[model samples]
Target: MEKNNLYPVFLKTAQLEILIVGGGFVAEEKLHFLTKSSPDAQITLVAPLIREGTAEKAKAFQVHLVRASYHAGYLQGKHLVIACTDKPQVNEKIYQDCRLRNILVNVADNPPLCDFYMGGIVTKGHVKIAISTNGKSPTTAKRLRQFFEEILPEDISWMVENLNRFRKTLKGDFESKVHKMNEVTQHLITNKN
Candidate 1:
């Protein structure tokens, strides 16, 4: 069997126990992503000294800020871990520790140690588009995301709501449902209006 790499997924982070092992700018950047991606994500930062805006962002996003250094024990209850300290050795150690326990981990800016890459995302209400370059170029992913964000209309959420309602009313097998949904949604693409 071929190993399927980089399976993209949107996680419900609200109930997850997430840990970040740093308090500097690197940690702040990671925090920005998490807070934006999953606003209610259960995040805990294990850093001795947080930067100025880190606390504000944490507060805005409801992150748990711990004024302490990273420790292996901190990894015990985390569903996902991000190692973002200035020390490469510390990040590598965190990655290894996560590996030993079969946990998903990402060492910031270190692709080799990352189990997953946080790709660019465009979201409008219930609709979301995730873009990835298989960890090659994040800039491209970011550009694509911006383009999508521009093209996708604000009222598109209305269509999404209608389609969801229609989907709930659908009663058929998988293929039949797909056919019906396609038939219903085809006009949105084909119509020049």
Candidate 2:
């Protein structure tokens, strides 16, 4: 049997059910990213106890918090699961359960057990850049994220919105008049300066 390698996947599980199996800082950080990216997602957090600030934030954000120990049954019907507990055994169990259930799972600090890896992401409207080191070095990913943050134009959001509008307007003709559309977009972007 071929072993599955860890890689980054662009998931469109927005507004879907996501289960988080931890309550510490790591779990909170994952939740923060998910909420920021997909605010409408129904998030269910399963943990015996959550850290102080996390509980308040979960309450404020309306995330469902289930106070319970790690169990394989919790993996059922979840679109995705994140194991952020410090306990290696717990993380491994969650990963195994997710694998059995065909659900995507990310185990904090354990790349080997993860089905998908989270990359450093920078988003401006519909434009997004994701940086990953393939779990070799997170520091490299962070540095790349910093570089993108500095280099990405602040007007990216406006550009993205304009491009979206242009695409909608062009519609089915976009395939035949690609160059003309690009030229028009470039003209618009340049004129915005």
Candidate 3:
């Protein structure tokens, strides 16, 4: 059997228990997206002093705020960890801890310590597109995301909902259901104009 590399898995971190080691703007930005996707996600923000904006947002969203510096123990049992602190040593320590625990870790703007890069995501209902360059150029990824965000129609959610209903109503084998779904999707896209 071939060994599987986790870097290639396009995972949905929506329900994951995530630990963010920072309370600055960077950490708040990350939290903003995470909470938007999954309001119920268990997020623990660890920092010595929480910025007002970060503290207020955390309080509003009921996020767990741990007022302390980065420690190896803080990484325990966390499915995903993010190091957004300005201190290079603290970020490095978190990365090493993640490696030891086999947990996924991303150090903000530090490609060397990042196990996986967080891409710009555009989600329309059930359909989602994640744009990434494997840390080559983040600006390019943001541009692509903006383009997709503009082009993707807002009515895509209606199409997805109808397709899901069709799937539920159909009683057939896997291949037949897939064929029917493709037909529905084609019809929806064509008539959407």
Best candidate (score: TM-score): 1
Q: Could you say which candidate leads in lDDT?
A: 1
Question: Given candidate 3, what's the lDDT at residue 179?
Answer: 90
Candidate 2 structure lDDT? 0.80
Task: Encode model 2's per-residue lDDT on 58-124: one tens digit a residue.
Answer: 7767898999998888776788888998899889988888888899888988988877777778776
Error of 1 at 79 (Å): 0.7
Please list the C-alpha lDDT of all candidates, in the order they appear: 0.88, 0.80, 0.83
**Candidate 3 lowest-lDDT run of ten:** 1-10
Better of 1 and 3 by lDDT: 1
Candidate 1 regions off by >4 Å? 1-5, 191-193
Q: How many backbone clashes does candidate 1 have?
A: 0
| Model 3: residues with Cα > 4 Å off, grouped in runs | 1-14, 187-193
1-193 in candidate 1: lDDT tens per residue? 5443778888999988999889888888889977887898999998889988888888888788989878889988899999999989989999999999988999989999999888899988888888888777889999999999999998888988988998999998989999999998788679585
lDDT of 3 at 52: 95
Clashing residue pairs in candidate 3 are none
TM-scores, all models, native as reference: 0.92, 0.83, 0.85
